[model samples]
Target: MTAQQPAGGAAIPQRPAVDFGRRYITFETPRFAGRTPRRTMIVCAALALVILGAGLASLTLGAYEVSFGAVIRAIFDPASDPDARQVVFEWRLPRVLFAVLCGAALALSGGIFQSLTRNPLGSPDIIGFGVGAQFGVTLVMIVLELNTYLWKASGALVGGLLTALLVYALASKGGTSAFRLIIVGIGVSAGLGALTSWILITVSVEKAMMAATWGAGSIASLGFDQLAPAALVFAVILVLTLPLTRRLPVLEMGDDAAAALGIDAGRTRFAAVVLGVALIALVTAAAGPISFIALAAPQISQRLTRSNSPMGTLPVMLTGAALVVVSDAVAQLATVPVGVVTVSVGGIYLAWLLAAQYARRA
Candidate 1:
């Protein structure tokens, strides 16, 4: 460390730059970051404007006519118009909220899985989360469609959890290996995917068509009836996860360090896994299995914020919201569902991530 000079200049500590055996990774230590408070405020405000403006555009551009002013009025003062209110309140509002909710949940879920696995490639969908949910829904729709929405949600949750649980049991022993987890998750996902395909093929053509449609994760024709409950479920899980942020930091220190810090390492990890899986499941149940927001959001935010760790809450949520809203907008104009856009886009992202991981290994 260097001391300050009398000329109002302070010397700072210097050290030789080291590599992680591949490339150097460094970040602002919650201090000395290039962004000032004013810049951060401006950026956040701009992002909020973008989101709000997009919502207004979405509301007005639909089949029924609702002006920007009317939409705004309806948003603030609940009882605006009997007809326009139905348009904004019943239809557009839920879709917008669902888009935001799904985006936030998926990103948070991605951050958790990546942090837990210590891999940039870790995400629920990448590791068969969508397939798992598909399997769950397939089972429900094929054999038992009588379950209530809550029960159906439970089925989806169990399906995703069991799938991940199977992957972990198969791949992890003494220590969890990021590489192994991905491989196992891929194989398991593939098999589940095959099973899903088989179920679709073997059933009646109408049933198969129905399953195929929902699998794409469309937000089309979604109303408050479904959105309200789904949002509530996701919110509850999200709240439960807030305090566990510290545990995640500790977990990055490895099992031993986590235990040394008085965390029941196994228990903390299990809880994080359950929470992450539950969030993904909620989205999957409500909106069919969304493709890559979980995988893409955390990784994108990691690069954006230049954070050394997986994305924290605020950044990840914003990044996710931006992606889904933008994608949803694309979906509307393209004569396609949101799911197709995500899968296509997410497929490309997954390939790049794989290449990067391989390059780092090399």
Candidate 2:
């Protein structure tokens, strides 16, 4: 125990720094207990290894067989094997990169939203931003016929921002609560989903088919052309997000407590929402609303690390990358879009979450 002198000159007991091996590490301050940077880095390394293994498996086991040696050679020296070069560099690599980036973005976004609302169910997907992005893409791709990467991306960003605005407006009338935001979000999401469906229904058959494929959320056709822009945006937004997340744990103590701690809970919440929405919208534009990654990744990361926070941002991001990359690989085997796989898997997980919540309440 450590002692501290206050204005009253009384010493209060404080827990000393604790390190529980490589598995867990933390330190206690006068204010709160938090994970050490080293512990977070270890978790990140472990998750990165999983993503790397999964990515390598993805690169090797595809439509055309390529040896591990061939993959390495193709990556390092593309001219050695034309087939390997084309398959690896021109095709598989972009898909894998998009999956990893998109997954990380969604996972980070989910963590922010979950932390802000203090609810497990509060994710970008559940709160309607995903649907709104889709709606925006539908308008750009189907109606405007400006289906280029940049245009589609812009549409998704605008749509997601609008949806977030609406959700905030509805929930903030009497001051926002997690429950109110979720309820309003569900209604907004349903409405936006219907609008997307209607757009699909009204388009020409050719256009409808194209839109449907995009909606299914396949990263198969994307190249560096799409990946570069999305990556740039994600990188910039992530830089902005990291500073805000330091204040996120403060909100868990409630608004008044957070205020007493000299944190602006409302401004922090708004910044978080804006950053989170931007992250998800970029992914949706790059890969279509891939579904449930934002919902599942952070929660899964939290459980794995046994952390009190919904998800340590780094772990959540790496976990999301792993989840999406692995799921993309599985979806490839089935010759289906990754979204199909995620939705099916996420639906079951959501059901289990609901059941557990009910059982706990009962």
User: Relative to the true structure, how large is the alpha-carbon lDDT of every model?
Assistant: 0.79, 0.87
What residue pairs clash in candidate 2, if any at all?
A: none
* Count of backbone collisions within predicted model 1: 0
C-alpha TM-scores of all predictions: 0.84, 0.88
Worst 10 residues of 1 by lDDT: 34-43
What RMSD does each model have against the real structure?
6.0, 4.8
Q: At residue 167, what lDDT does model 2 achieve?
A: 92
What are the per-residue Cα lDDT tens digits for candidate 2 across 1-362? 67889998779989877865555457798999976655567678988998988898889868799999899898888467998989988889988999899899999999998888888899988989888888898999999998888898889889988999999899889987889999999999999988888888887999999899889998888889988888898899988888666688778878898899899877888888788888878988878879999999989988877677874777999999999999999998898999999999999999998798789889
Clashes of each: 0, 0
Best-fitting candidate, measured by lDDT?
A: 2
